[model samples]
Target chain A: MTPSSGASARTQPLDHKEIVAAPRTLVLVGNPNVGKSVLFGALTGKYVTVSNYPGTTVEVTRGAAEIGGLRWHVLDTPGTNNLLPMSEDEQVTRDILLREPEYVCLQVCDAKNLRRGLLLACQLAEAGVPFTLALNMADEAAARGIRIDTDRLSGALGIDVVSTVAVQRTGLPLLLERIPEAGVSKFRPRYDAAIESALSELEPLLPAARLSRRSLGLMVLAGDDSLQPWLASGASAVRLERIEGIRRALASRYPESLRFVVARQRLAAADRLHDQVVTRGKASAGSALARRIGAWSTDPVKGIPVLLLVLAAAYLFVGVFGAKTLVDFLENTVFYDHVVPWTEAFLRFVVPAGAVQEFLVGPPGLPFRETSGFVIGKYGLVSMGLAYGMAIVLPIVATFFLSFSVLEDSGYLPRLAVMVNRVFKWMGLNGKAVLPMVLGLGCDTMATMTARIMETRKERVIVTLLLALAVPCSAQIAVIFAMLQGLSFAASLWFSAVIVLVLFLVGWLAARVIPGRGSDFVLELPPLRVPQLGNVLVKTLARMEWYLREALPLFVLGTLLLWVLDRTHMLGLVERAAAPVVVGILQLPEQSASAFILGFLRRDYAAAGLFQIYQPYMSTGTMTRVMEIQVTVALVTVTLFIPCIANFLMILKERGWKTGLAISAFVLPFAVGVGAAVNLLMRRFY
Target chain B: MPALVQRQERCPLCGMAFDAEGQGCRPSCPLATGCRVVCCPSCGYSFPQESGWAGKLKGWLDRRKEAGR
Candidate 1:
């Protein structure tokens, strides 16, 4: 049959009638974006039919091609990172593998990212699927100084392995010739004794399917609920219940999840195979320099200096220039000098002077307030909200985002993780925790969710706790930097030292208290390169936009809430109620109580409040020693304080109510106690 | 000839390429409904999906590369 004719007939669900009617199938499988479709196009020229897999949105494409003098039904399955399936697309891909009969698989892999590809390869091998490997993107791999010995790999896996650039049709003939020689790989990752025993017992209970019983058993062990349908179809309920019992029993034996243990073994096997066959050469000049710098940045001894240098640069740029210079120009020259006067004049002309005007701009000449008009009041939208969000926090965050983007785009962030891996070990976490922690610097709510990347619940909780307790988000950090600008370098050092100590102490304590094992760190580091200017700018702008959308509104809301409290005389009541902690313990002005109240809404908002209170002290360049100590204590306390409402909600969502509440319960008192202690210590020393 | 119809985005963090539209956030996430972040199915690394001028810039770059090729 012609390709289109075959495709038209076979594109629908492969029912029993069609399965019998169709020819033997050649299924294309691989990770997404690895040129699977391109390979499919190369195999079956010009005509194909695409249809959704029955009852699902996942599209499955089918066509016919003459390969090695035989008409083969070509099935292009969905791209999947894991055959076990995590998402709908991956589930569909796994389902195709489970359902298809008399099929030979063609596993397309990215040549540069061989380790990740081999993870799927290992899964296929475990499933006893007869497959041929195509290491696509050979040219890109070569460009990046990566080389693979296909012959050695083929020998190792006992299967055909061909290096091809599918887009260029580089090794099409060779791949075509090897298609008929596809064979089941003998490779099997060695699991732990407990898991092996469970698998051995479970295998006999499972009914035969396209995949081996051992593979099915492993899937069960990994808690892959997507396999429920296939398992239900084959195994008796009694057998399934017994399988669950075995899974639970095995799970209880290990501190970590069984899925992590299984994945770790597979990753270990892939790494060994990779080491055996892959070699590196000199890359292009730019990348070569980057590679050298990347190496130095991850080195134990050298990495410290590199990290310190980067930090100093960031401090000077963000703290000195952005906070001091940009903020001065914006706040003084832009807002105080021009915008405030123009806005007050405009509001006076537009609206009759009364409560509405006072509410909008704030009462004229209010005590301790900088400008006149309600909008320029202590809680005015224009004076406090817009000034803090646009002028003070914006410049600081923008600069931070710029520096952070450069670090991220240059591929230094992962290396920073590696450098800190030893320290993370103390916390029962691997270097992988750094990704979320680093992300916490951007936004803790997102980072709390990203903590799912950790292998164990223990590590996730620890990471989340650290994120909530100490890792101030970007805007908060910017405000902190601005606050610190008024203090001595020693004060900054004290704040850093205390936060670091708290992080390690809490992490160490939580690791011991929480019950689970940490996974081995096995992150694949991308080749370092100079940060692209366009990419950095795009990332920075994107982050700035996020701040504008997600955070700026909170500033306005906070100002409005504060304004209402002030107007209702509730501000005095609340300030008096919080006096013991804010004034007595933290030794801050009674006015700083409002900042603490606002801190719960958003950490940056509170910091900005303190910044507003400290502004007079900073601008005059005449901050008293007592004022310096108070600012230091307040900044440190806020940094270690309870996370903002959004992050708290996220923590509750991710960790569930009990753990989330427990975290908050511990953090609140701990933050106040730390602040108190710092108050006493700074008083004694400084 | 299988028609290549779907577009994919590679996760910069984990290098796992996925169909951005198909990879939904966890159902329980409060921000799930209207979140603009594209989460990696494999690694769970969430990043804002590129759009507007950023997307245009990337498209322009890709087209330039294609034209050169």
Candidate 2:
């Protein structure tokens, strides 16, 4: 029989010409790193270049293969954990399953990780997709002492199941023979009453697709927004609204989201199925040791010491090595000695010795001048902007990113979250808040958006407030390290203590003042492994590239703005205007006012400005006790200063304008007030 | 012709894997026009997308590793 003749036409009208021209498709779907690629290559006989699926950036590989004496188009989809479509890759994979006219799936599973594979299989069976199960990596599973009863699993699910080690081409002939006999399984997970009723109501409203209406209804009940396009294609507005109403009614019945409830039910069912069909024995010695370390890393008692050791190592690497050693070598030896002098001379010789030249480097004189620097001059783009970006900030962020990537790749971040769960509870947030809070160290703007993951608005608002007030981005932290490296250990301790104190104090207050309650923390921790060197380098390089592209220009712009203000004599006026705060209250020099002014544009810019100001005091070796106190005060104040423009705008976007404005209004004065108190108390004591 | 395929990125914080070119922030976002950061659709976590040269280098590394294996 022809392929199109048997193709189901319950969804959209089939394109006759297209169906006849296209070969029968066999899609391979599975979890990530499950040997799907190996299976696909074995099935298709060659690797194929991937191309983006239409209207998406998701790449799906298609290759021609002969299975059962029929030409088949083998499609290797992006690995996805769930068909409910959490991310774009998952969404695209689901769409292919829903929209493909005539296709059968080859559900690949890692024999060792049956539970994870079964989770996806349960969803596929519910979708009514005709598929055959290929439990790949059987050899590795046997080595690990994991055994699966394939016959029992097949009989339970009503589908053909084949065990194969794809690398060795085992069971290839059997898998091929079963492709022609692929049939939809009758397996369906029984959800709770509320979800079942909602699905029943939603099923009638959803349009027909390659997937069963029940499956589509489940996705709708899960709040999969990526399905909107597919749902809106031919469905009426009233039907969509009714479907939404049913979803809302069901969601209101539970304290948690419908998505969470649905996911939990599916996972519970997968666990039950797994227990029935699989038996586990002792794992290998290497994996057993890795498991022990992973457990210790998350233990409440043991994890604290691990966390501290990690922090100390990070400080030594990023603080002492990256910030001080690298910055001194690059800034003083490379730029000041060579690049700055050479660029200044070259610009002077190339251009006239007037406005353009002055703008390029800085004015000819040192102290004061009418003209501003552009490239090699005082405010010169190359000297101050590029130098700070490349010489000072680059090494620090590079080292931080490298360490962070190692932590991420080694799977310690989730453990870190687990360790911090209790402290987060005091702030009316769960451990999930740590993800955004920790991410704020990299970039507050992105972290503000990441606040969406928090279950409650109160939790999000508190996290956002704390991020703006106390959490300094990596660049600012780097500059803080640079500024404090010259002082005693007590100075660094004081800065850290003040920042931590403010975070906890404000978080405690916000919990009581905010209107909503917090949710329980439930996080999935991946198995910890050694960090991959290639992955770490790629991630570090990507982040360093981002700093150069997105942040470097802002540094130049901030410098140019300051230079223009100085040239117009406006900078001095602004400084004198704020003298009461700068000189009187804070006891900082009037010139330091520019740092505070530039602090609003970008926190790192202001910190860098302060670093420039503090350099002379350190280099001259005439630093007094009072000078050391001022440095700590300045760093503390800047760290607590207003969020940068990008982050501020994101705050408004995510938290609404009222809460955004209120957060800024509270943070600005609170930061200064704390700074004033610190200054007064430290001077009296020291 | 060279195949047109976008790289995939995973959010380190949440482990949400996504296409690097898909699931951008809203177009109304000021940074959306030329934004190079890949935002996670699942959790809203954002990270810088790899540059072309970095992507090439990674592909080359993976290929060499595969050959060695």
Candidate 3:
């Protein structure tokens, strides 16, 4: 049978004489954001009207235009990434192609990304559509040192190819002139013989449609269900069953999805076409600079120093500027010097002296008198919870988010993933896990959710366990640095060493135990462009908002729990219950038990509790060596403890209760065990 | 007309520096509609897309290139 004679004629072939006599429909089709609409406006001017495609919600714009004194109808279809009807929008584009086979297709493409555009061109070619390929945004390609030889590309495809900067109307005259000569691409994507035979069998049964029967058969073989409406309308049950049998026979031939197989063939054709016509020259100055930085960032040798500089810069900003400068001003000057006094006076005026007054303002003495603790007491909601949330944690989270956004915008995070892949491989994980691990520093709760990106359940569980046990959130880290900065730099070193050791030991053990294969390392290192200040500010503000929303209420709840524990005398009972572990083995003060317990509410809240203990040193002007060792042990234990309540709940949600509870069970005992060991070792050495 | 700036990003896997935001989604990806990740055109590895004013500025320059031509 001829190509057009079999089930291929889904619709009546347009009468050649009639098509030439009437006004032609020129359809503009492309991937999204590819300047299709701009070209539409430039070609048709003010003559466009948009309405939803019939039977679908996707809008298609139609207008009238005059090209070379011939009046033509122009239809600007919705942006479709593919012609295979993967979505309702794409289905509409495909439907239009099937309905009006005579319409001329103008395929607009991004000149900088030709392969993707060429993939669609391949699809159009298989459909037997007469089309012209317009390579848009030529200037961008040029700036990136990309030069596509349109003449050679045209020769390869045996179709007219015109390069146009549509926004500037550079090649409009030539493009318009070439449209009339549009012809089917001489190039075709070849499928396997089995698929070709299946197409022949299905072609006889398919009713006349605009798409070639071969393309329709390929869609059918690939299991596209979106064509059910059309199939139901035309095919008898016997024909449908035969088509299904053909599909099943084809499916048995491949181990992978036929869709993937077909796509691979098409892309291979695109790549071959690209190699013939595309050339790269020297990059422009800005792109060259970004490329150089991107190269240095992932180079194993150069990346080490770059990583150190980044860490140092983060410490200088968050620890020094944020915790020291911003926190000092907000807490000391704003809250302590003004707001506390104002709240006290207001409380004194509102209530008469009694038990009630004492509960609210703590007997009107020093802020930490430690009596009658409630709303205004030393550990009260206002005094400690709100102060810590707004004054201390806010600056820390703000600076951290600011720095993080810059790293993200500059595209350094993926390179970091590459650099760390080797180390991660030791733990049966790969570089891809680094995304969520870095994210865990911002907030373990969100990072636990992001662990879903890992390829296997085993990798997710390991990453989640590590994040819970070792990655201290930004607030906790900030408070740790602040507290340790006063004691000694070695204090911070001890804390880091202990956490790193715990992470590696646990990861190594878990990798051996976990039962799935880790995904291989693969990451895209985006160019290291200069981050825009505006984007960084917007992202920082967004993260700060998330911090306030997530952390503030937990702070208040933690403080209230503390107050209730004290009031019910449960605090003393628990402290006494853990006294042997708290004071005897760990060598921490009895009061330190309360901080460890509060850490279960929020890691940073517990860190803030430790901060309060060290604050008196500012006035006393000395940190005893014993206090330093105790502080170091406390920080390490808190860092390795079970994830905070929010993150625990997320783990339970994402990983299911069994694994989540198992992880929590493991971490609780492991953290204390490591803390006890660290205490003994440090005491012996220091 | 001024030369347009090409936002080239190198894929770590293949080292092809295509337009960072210009990569297209695979036909089968369900998240293709609103996902904020950019796929590498060469290797198909997805990374987070750059956001905010910088992406907007790059878009504006692309449009300017179209118009200037």
Best by lDDT: 1
Q: Each candidate's lDDT (Cα)?
A: 0.80, 0.78, 0.75
What DockQ class does candidate 2 belong to? acceptable
Q: lDDT score of model 1? A: 0.80
lDDT of 1 by residue, A1-686 (tens): 11222212223344334433446689999977788999898877755778898879998988777676766778899877777665678888888888877899999998978988998999999999999999999998887678899999999898999999998988877887788779999988898788899999999988899998888889889888888887898888998899999999999997555765788678778878987898877444565577678889888898999999988998898878887899889988998788877887787678777787766665555431643334776677777789888988788778887888788777787788878877898888977898888778777877787788776778889998999999988778778877787888888888888899999999999889988767655555666877778778777776676556667777888888887787788989999999999998889999899889998898778888898888887978998889888888888888887657888888988899999999999998898899889889989997
For each candidate in turn, the TM-score is 0.73, 0.68, 0.63
Model 2 TM-score (2 dp): 0.68
Residue range A1-686, candidate 2, lDDT tens digits: 12221211123322334323447889899987667888887776643546788889998887666676666677899988789875678888998998889999999987877877898999999999999999988997786578899999999899999998988978777888887799999889999887887788789889989999998898888788888988898699999899989988898897656765787688779877987898767433365577678778877798888889888988888888888898889988998888877777777788887766666766665521123476765566777778887888788878877888788778888788777877888888867788778777877776787787785789899999999999998788778877776777887788899999999999999999989877655455555777778888887787666555557767878878887888899999999998999788888988989989989988888888887788877777777888888888888888898658778887888798999999999988888888898899889876
Q: Return the lDDT, model 1, position A663.
A: 93
- DockQ values per model: 0.29, 0.31, 0.06
lDDT of 2 at A150: 95
After superposition, the stretches of candidate 1 with alpha carbons farther than 4 Å from their true spots are: A1-29, A32-105, A111-115, A118-131, A135-177, A183-285, A363-373, A618-626, A684-686, B1-7, B27-32, B56-69
Q: Candidate 2: which stretches are off by over 4 Å?
A: A1-285, A363-372, B1-22, B32-34, B40-44, B66-69
**Interface RMSD of candidate 1?**
2.9
- In candidate 1, residue A1 scores what lDDT? 12
